[model samples]
Target: MFILADDMGFGDFGVFNGGQSSTPQLDDLSGISRLYSQHTSASPVCAPARAALLTGRYPQRTGVIDTLEARGTDRLALDEFTIADAFSRAGAVTGLVGKWHCGAIGEPYHPLKRGFDEFIGFRGGWQDYWDWTLERNRTPVQADGRYLTDVLGDEAVGFIRRHKHERFFLHVSFNAPHFPYQAPEELIGQHRRTGRTERVAVIYAMIAVMDRAIGRIRQAISDAGLDDDTLIVVTSDNGPELGGDGEESADRWNVGLRGAKQHVFEGGIRLPLVLSQPGVVAAGEDDTFIHLTDWYPSLLTHAGVTPVGSKVLDGRDISGSFTGGTVDDVPRCWQWSRYHPMPTSNAAIRDGRWKLVHPAAAGTLGLTDRDEWIDHDIKRHPENYAQPIDEESPGWPAVGTEPMLFDLAADPEEAHDLAAVHPDVRARLATALHAWYEDVELDRARLVST
Candidate 1:
C-alpha cells in the first residue's frame, strides 16, 4: 500500500508541525513506522516527481519533463517500464486511486494502459474538489456529494477488500491541500476559530479531512486481516504550494526549510516518508538520503518481484535500508522549468551534504498560452487534442549566472552560499551536474526523434 499526499509540506504532519495542523493519524503512524529524515522527491513539481516515482528513472529520461499536458510534456514514454508493470507481471492485482498526473491526454497515456488493472481518479494536475469527474477504468463517474478525499479513500478500501485473498498493490493518492481548498464547514470552522485566515483555514481543513480518510484506510487494512502481511508507505509527491496574493494566499509553516513547490531548494523537494510493516521494518528514524525513485526498485525487491525489462534504472534497491542497513550515498540531480526544459535554469545536484544550484532566472517561470485551455478542454474532450508524442520545442532565453554552493549539513535553510569558500567542490559538482543534464536531454531527444 502506497499513500501519497499532494502539496503536503514537511510541517503539515502534526509530528513535525508543533500542532499547527491536524494530522493525528499520520503522527501516530510515524511512531510505528521508520521515518526518513532526508527523503526527497525526485522533482520539485507533480508530473515529473510522479514520473520518477513510477519509473525507476529520472523524469527527463522518461519524457515527462514538465506539467503542461496539452503540449504533451507530461506524458511518460511508452517504452518505460513502471513498478506496476513488474508487480502485475508477477501476478499481483494492481489498482491506482486519486491523481494520475503523469499523463492526461490520450488513451495511450491513461493509467489503465500503464500497468494498472483498476484506476479510479482524475487524470489531470488538479480538479475541483466539490465537483469532480473521475474515471473508473476509462468510464467517467460524476461526483456524488462526498468529498473527493473520502471518495478516494472509500475506493481504496474497496480495492483492498476485493483483493484481500490475493497479492495486490494499491496506490492511494490524495489530492489534498493542493488547491481549490474546499472542506466541510465543520473542519473549516475549527481552524478558523484558531485565528487562521480563510485560505490557511481551508487548506488545513483539507489536510485534516485527508488525515481522517487515511486513518479509515488503515482500519480497513486491519479489518481485512492483512496488517502483518502488508507493507504501508506514506509520502507526498512534493512540498507545499505557498500560494499567491490575498485570499488565494496559502503560505504556512514548512518546518524552517527553504523555498516552495517549484524551487530546487530543500523545502521544495524534501518530503516526509514513513514505512510500516509489522516485523519487517522496525520503528525508528533513518537519516539516509532516500529519493522517490528508490521506491520503484525497493518495493519490487520487497515483494520478491523482478523488474520486467532490462532498461537501466537510475534508482537502486534500498530495501535493506528498511531494516537499518546502510545505503550508498549517490549523487542526485534536479532541473525543471515551464514549457520546454531549460537545463541551466533552476537546476541542482546534491552529492552528500554539499549541494550546487543554478537559481531560476527572473521572468523564466510563466505558463505558456497552451496552459490556458489544456486543463479544461483536455479533461472533458481529450480526443479533440491528440498531441504529438513530441511537440516542437519552444525557444527560451538563456540564463547566465555562477552556481551557488551550500553545505546542507550546516545550513539546511540554504541561506548562505559557500561557492567562494569551496571553489574546488563547486567546479567538480558543476561538471557532474551539467554532464547529467546533457545525458538526460540526449535521451529525451532520442525519444522525440523516434
Candidate 2:
C-alpha cells in the first residue's frame, strides 16, 4: 500500500515531532516503521511531485512541474511508464484511491489508461471535501454527507479485503488536511478549545481524522494476515500549506523550516516518510535523502520485479536504505514553476550536505484572471477554503537575485547563506543543476507529442 497525504508537512504527524495535533496512531506506527527524516518530494507542488513519485523520474521529464488547474488540459504524458504498469506486468493488481491530479481531461490520459486496474477519486488539484463528485474508473458517483477522507480509507480497506489472497498494489492517496480544511465539527472544536485559530484547528482535526483512518487500514492488513507479507509506505505529497491567518500556527506546523508549499525550501520539499513491512523492513529512523522519484525503482526492486521498458529514470534504487542502510552522499534536485504552456527554467541541486537554488527569469503564459473562474466564497464555511493550484500571475518572481547556498547538515532551517564562504561548492552545484535542467528540457518533446 502506497499512502500519500496531500499537503501534509514534516511536523504534521507526531512521529515527525508534531505537537500541534494528535497523531497517536501514526506515532505508534513510527515506532515499528522505518522513519526517514530527510525524505523529500520531487517538486513542491502536488501534481508534479506525484508525477515524479509514480514515474521514478523528475517532474520535468513527465511534463508536470506545476499543479493542474480545474479542468486543466496539462497532464502526465501517455507514453510515460508508471510504477503501476511495472507492477501489473509482474502480476500484481493495482488500485488507486483519492486524488488523481495527473490527468483527467481525456480518456487516454485517465488513471485506468495509465495502468491502474481500479481508480476512485477526482482528477483536479483540489475538490470540495464535504460535497464532491468522485469517479470509479470513469463513472461519476455521487457520494454525499460522507467525508471524502473516510470514504477513501474505507475504499482502501475494501480493496485490501477483496485482494487479500493476491499481490495488490493499492495507492491510498488521501486529500486530507489540504485546503478546504474540513473535519467533523466536534473534532474541530476540540482543537479550537485549545486556543488554536479556526484554520489551525480545522487542519489539525483533519490530520487527526486521517491518522485514525490510517490506523484502521493498518489494522485491516494485520487482520487479513498480510502484515508481514505486505509492504506499506506512507508519506506526504509536499509540505504544509501555510496561508490564511496562520502566523501562530505556521511555526507549529512548519517545525522551524523556512518556506511552505510552492517554495523550494527545506520546509516545502523535506517531508517525512515511513516504511513498514514487519520483518522485511527493520524498524528504525534514518536520515536518507530519498526523493519521491526513488520510490518507483525502490518499490519495484522490493517487489523483485524489473521494469519492462528501456526508460530513462533519474531516480536510484535505494531499497537498501530501508534495511538499516545509509544514503548520506546521494545527490538530488528540485524545481518549480506555475502551470504554463512552456517548461520552468530554474532548478536546485542537493549534493550531500550542500544545497543550491537558482530561480529563472519569469515567462509569460498570456493568461488573465478573467479567463478562469476563481472560487471566491470557499472561506466562508469551515468545510471549504481556497484552492492553491490556480495559474500564476505574470509578475510572480521567476528568479532570485543570486544563487542561495546552505550547508543543510549545519543549517537545516536554511537560515544562513554560505555562498560567500563556499564559492567553489556553489559553482559546482550550479553547473550540475543547469546541466540537469537542459537534459529535462530535451525530454519535453515526449510530453509535447503526447
Best candidate per lDDT, number? Answer: 1
Model 1 root mean square deviation, Cα atoms: 1.6
- The per-model lDDT (C-alpha) reads 0.88, 0.79
Q: What TM-score quantifies how close candidate 1 is to the native fold? A: 0.97
Off by over 4 Å in 1: 193-195, 380-383, 386-394
**Model 1: per-residue Cα lDDT over 179-274, one tens digit each:** 767999998888874445689889889999999999999998999999999999999999998957876678888988989898888989999899
Candidate 1's displacement at residue 189, Å, is 1.1
Cα lDDT of candidate 1 equals: 0.88
Candidate 2 per-residue lDDT, tens place, 1-450, comes to: 899999998878865554567898888888889988888999878888999999998887887755544424347877788998998888999999999888745567789988899999887766777887788987887767888888898889999999999999999999988877678999887777455567787888999889989988998998999999999998999988785655345335567897887767888888878899998898987887889988999899999988756888888888998789865457788877654422233457899889997544354322355433442222122123223344445565444447889998999999999889999999898888777777886787656665
Which candidate leads the pack in TM-score?
A: 1
